[model samples]
Target: MFYWRRVGRIWPVHLVALPLGIYAFYVAAKVDIDWPGLISSVFLVQTWFPDVTPTLPGNPVTWTLSVELLFYALFPLVAPFADRMRTRWLMVATAVGLFGMYLVNWVADATLDPTMARWVMRHPLVYLPEFLLGMTMALALRRGWRLPLHPVVPLAGLFGWTYLYYQERWPFSDVVEHQMEFAMRPMVGVLSALIILAFLQREARGHRGILNNRLLVSLGLWSYSFYLVHHAISRLATYEFGRMPDNNAVLFTLIGMAVVINVICWALFTYVEEPAEKWWRKHTPKRWLDRGGETGGSALPPAPRREAETAPAPV
Candidate 1:
C-alpha cells in the first residue's frame, strides 16, 4: 500500500508531465532524448544507471524523484532499525551520515569525469547518507530532542548560508567545492528537519507563524504539482523568450511566469493528484501489502457504524 500510494500520488502527474518534459527539452535544449533513458525514467530508476544514458531524458528535475523513489523503496527496511536506536546513537548516526556524504563528495571528485561526477551527486546510493540523516533526525525528534535555536532564526541562517555557498563566498578546498555543489541537499535536509520540529514545538505551545496561515496552507497542497510542472513552464518560457532585455525584464518575466504556473498547478493538483490518491485508497483493500499503519494513505480513522442505520426498523 505504501508503494501503491506513492505510485498513485506521483505516477499520474508524472505520466502527464513526461511528454511535456520531453517537448520542453526538445524546445529548450534541442536534444533528441534517448529511448533507453526514457525507459529508466518510466521505471523511476534512471539515476541508477546514469553512466549508460542521461537519467533526465524527460525532465532534469525529475532526477530527484528517482532518488526519492529509491528512498521510498528502502524506508520500510530502514525504519525499523532507525526506530530502535537511542537518541544519543541517533545523533551520532546523523553526524556519521553527514560526514559520509562529504567522503562521497571527495571520492567522486577524485575519480569520476565531470558528467559522471554530476550523475554521482544525484545517484541514490550517494544520497543514502542524506536520507539516513533525515531518518536519524526524525527518530531523535520522536524521542523528544529539541533544537537549540528557534525555527525562523535557523531557517533564515540556512538560506543565508545557501546564498553564500552559491556565491562561492564559503571557503573551499577542491574536494569541498565538489562536495559543496550537492552538499546542500543533506545540509538543507538537516536544517529543514530542525525547522519542522521547532514549528511543531511552538505549535504545541499554542504559538503560530505565518506558515500556519490558511492561504499558504492551501498553496502547500498544490506544491507537488507545482514541483512537477514548474520546470516545464519555465523551460517553455525560456524557449519562447530567447533572452532578457534587462534585470527589470527578467524580474517581470519571472513574476508573470510564476502567476501562470501556479494557476496551472492549482488545476492539476485539484483535478489529478487528489482524485487519483483518493481513488486508489478507496478501491484498494486495507492492509494489502504490509501490517504497518503508514501506507501514506489518509490518516483519518474509519467512521463508526451506527447499528440502526444498517438495519430496517421493526415494521
Candidate 2:
C-alpha cells in the first residue's frame, strides 16, 4: 500500500501509543503481582506478549501491533489485490466477506478445540482482511473514488471509538473484540485519505495547507523512531516508578518520566532506526535482472521497490 510506505514515517502515532503504554504499565502494576510472568514475558523477546502488554488495563489495544507487524510483512502482496478490485461495490463486498468470516470465527470459537481456537485468534491469516481493507482504501483513493472528506467524520469516529474503548461495556467490548478489530482501519484510513486529497486539491487550486508546514513534516519524519523505542522506554519508567501511590505527585512523576523517555526515544530514532533503515536500503542487493546479471537462486527486487513492484498492477 502507498500508505504503508508512509507508515515508515509515522512518528506521531507513537506519541499516542507511548502515553497509553505508560498508562498500561501503571495499571498492570496496580492490578496484581505477576513479577515472574511479567519479567519472563519481557525477556522472552520472541513473542508479541512481551513487546506490548496485551492484557493490561487501559491498553487492550496493543494486540494490534502483532497484526500491524503481520500487515507490514504482507502489505506488499495485499496491495495488489486491492488495486485490482475496480469498483466500490467490489471493495465493499470484499470487506463484508472478511467481516463475515470473522463473525463465523466468533461463532466457531464456541465449539472449536481450545488449541485451534487460540491459533485462529492469533494467526496472521486472520488479519489479512483488515490489512487488505486498508490496502483497498488506498487503492480506491488512488483511482479517484470519491468519499466524503468532512473533518467531522474522522473526529466523530475517533471520539466514538475512544468513548466505546473506555466505557468497557458489553456491546462495545464485543464490537471492539470482533467487529471493531479493524476500527482504526476506517478512521485512520478516511482521515489520512481526506488529508491527502485535500492537500492535492489545495495545491491544484494554488493554496497551501498546514501539512506543508516544516515542523509537521519533520515530526512525521522522526515518528517511526519514536515508535520503535517508546514502548521500551515506557516500560522502563513503569518498572522504576510504578509502585508508587497513584496520587498527583506520582502522576506528575510518571508524566515527567514519560517525557524523558520520549526524548530518548526520539534520539534513538534519529540515530538508530532512521540510519539503519537507510543503510539497509542502500546496502541491500537489487534484483539480478536490474543489475544485468543472470545467476543466483532468485533475484528479489530491492527491498524498497519489492513492495511496490510486487503489488498487483491495477486492472
- RMSD in angstroms, all models? 9.4, 9.0
The TM-score of predicted model 1 comes to 0.85
Tens digit per residue, CA lDDT, model 1, 139-206: 55445555555787878978886887878645778656755665676678777777787787677558
Give each model a TM-score: 0.85, 0.58
Error of 1 at 299 (Å): 13
- For candidate 1, give the lDDT of residue 289: 35
Clashing pairs in 2: 11-223, 80-312
The TM-score obtained by model 2 is: 0.58
Give the per-residue lDDT of model 2 (tens digit) for 213-281: 997776676665555455655665557766667567888877786577657656766675666545544
Model 2 lDDT, residue 71, Cα? 71
Best by TM-score: 1
lDDT of 1: 0.73
